[model samples]
Target: MLHLILPSDLDALRELLDENPESLLDVAAVVNCLGTCGLCERRFVPVAPLVESLEPLYGDSKGLHALLRHNQYISLSEAICGFCHADPGLLNMFQKMKKL
Candidate 1:
């Protein structure tokens, strides 16, 4: 399935890479896993400090090489939605927050 929000244009992709080097690994990893994963809309969070600490790597290289160089689980899932057995109270709270 095509990513609804992610750009399909090469220049747009490059622009995104240039604008936010910190997102390099995350973008690369997601692109690499595209069309292969079952949960296409799944969201993930970095382990923190990992992406922030990748500036030196960004200066050296700018692809998956720089992205996945560190031996850290940066883009691992912090939370996920759209699943079975969700907590009703939590969902209610989210809905209420949306109304505020």
Candidate 2:
């Protein structure tokens, strides 16, 4: 299983932070995976640049923690993962809309 970071994931993470202030720990846990599939045990190449880029978007560690605790963030993560894994068409549509 490929484990590339998706823009939707970032957006979801951001939305999550916006909705709550205590989800940072959860977000950190997810980020720590570093491309290893939790279920399949498949090892994917780590995208360091992608991860680095996300760091600033969340501001500080505290900010990230808040996001993790946010309900919206959790929901967004589920939606993003569903789109990425089961509905690429939906993801593409969302990306296209963002371009406009």
Candidate 3:
């Protein structure tokens, strides 16, 4: 299956983050795949609840430890700048909303 972080996916993620900032750790900043990008295509997969786990961080450091070792978390600043700078190949597919 094709897995990519598309513009819509990013937008949805942003909304999700706004609603649930705690999920920050569960998300992966980038995923790459080749296909029609950002058309909201049924074929294009969305990354959400799937990559994110609902479990809270317990005293056990395994989850946080693994995240730190993995080094996959993107800073809030970087996530804000994600609009102009995302996976280049994926950015190429971003369909900017047209003004009416």
Candidate 4:
């Protein structure tokens, strides 16, 4: 649970799956799960405490706000490493690639 890793032995995949945060099998069983639940909605979780603490060091609230504002999915990454919303970030990048 503390860490996840896949071993070299192909037969040992089951054990690795067991330790995996998101199981490859029976994925739908994960309820309110950040990884695969399509219906689950994301609430705005703040990534402020760390920056706020360091804010006094920088003494630049405006700059900090500007930096944090664009990365609205900060908490999403901090909370669940792989869980990301399908939003303008992905679509925008794809659109740019298409243009290129």
Candidate 5:
């Protein structure tokens, strides 16, 4: 569950590496904890999440208007830089989902 690599998930992180192998391990410690950070682990990007932005529908007395917000996407530049710069696989637990 930590390193949930698949055909598509590999595509999403294809560009982010420093041994993003390290980043792979970075995500491992988290998934290991159903008792620790379980049930809420989806926040850590389990699959190559193609999460769409919620276009807010402003309900008014006038009419039910749905406004599509502009420029909601975030750049992965910083995150990529961080993964590339930081320690690679400190836990080094790339093979398993849990530390233990």
Candidate 6:
């Protein structure tokens, strides 16, 4: 049961990174701090490699062009297609505002 970070969480993290440029390490630390029951925690997965792997895949012909066209490669999971994640909270909020 990987407690995946919601879209809002990612957005918040991005904003945090922007605000405290020196806290880049802290940002990584927080992202790696998954809950005890999640797949990330169980597997002890480090986010560094994941972030590295997504760098080159963000550009064209990488199969993620559509999803990451506007977003820089900030993290691995962030590079994932929004449609694939289908975050419930984000979708619900968008629906309420008629923005979906």
User: How are the candidates ranked when ordered by TM-score, highest leading?
Assistant: 4, 1, 2, 6, 3, 5
Clashes of 5: 1
**Residue-wise C-alpha lDDT for candidate 4, range 1-100, written one tens digit per residue:** 2123334454354444334523322221222222322223443333344345334433555654444444434333333221233455654554565577
- Compute the lDDT of residue 40 as modeled in candidate 5: 19
lDDT against true structure, model 1: 0.41
- Which RMSD values do the candidates have, in order? 12.3, 14.8, 13.9, 15.0, 18.1, 15.3
> Tens-digit lDDT track for model 6 on 1-100?
1123212354454454345433333333445532121112222222334344333322222433223233322223422323322456644554565543
Candidate scoring better on TM-score of 4 and 6:
4
lDDT tens per residue, model 5, 4-73? 5422343344333212323433432444311112211222222111111111211121211111111112
Ranking by lDDT: 2, 1, 4, 6, 3, 5
Instruction: State in Å the error of residue 86, model 6.
Output: 44
Rate residue 32 of model 4 by lDDT.
Answer: 23
Candidate 1 lDDT over 1-100, as tens digits, reads 2244345665665566566544544543544432121233333334333334433433333353344434232333233233311446655665665578
Score every model by TM-score: 0.28, 0.25, 0.21, 0.28, 0.20, 0.22
User: Model 3: per-residue lDDT, tens digit, 6-95?
Assistant: 223544644554454434433332333112223232122122222333223222234433333322222212111232334565344443
Model 1 TM:
0.28
Clash tally, candidates in order? 0, 11, 0, 0, 1, 0
Reference-based TM-score, model 5:
0.20
Q: What is candidate 3's TM-score against the reference?
A: 0.21
Worst 10 residues of 6 by lDDT: 34-43
lDDT of each candidate versus the true structure: 0.41, 0.41, 0.32, 0.38, 0.25, 0.34
Displacement of residue 77 (Cα, Å) in model 1 is: 16
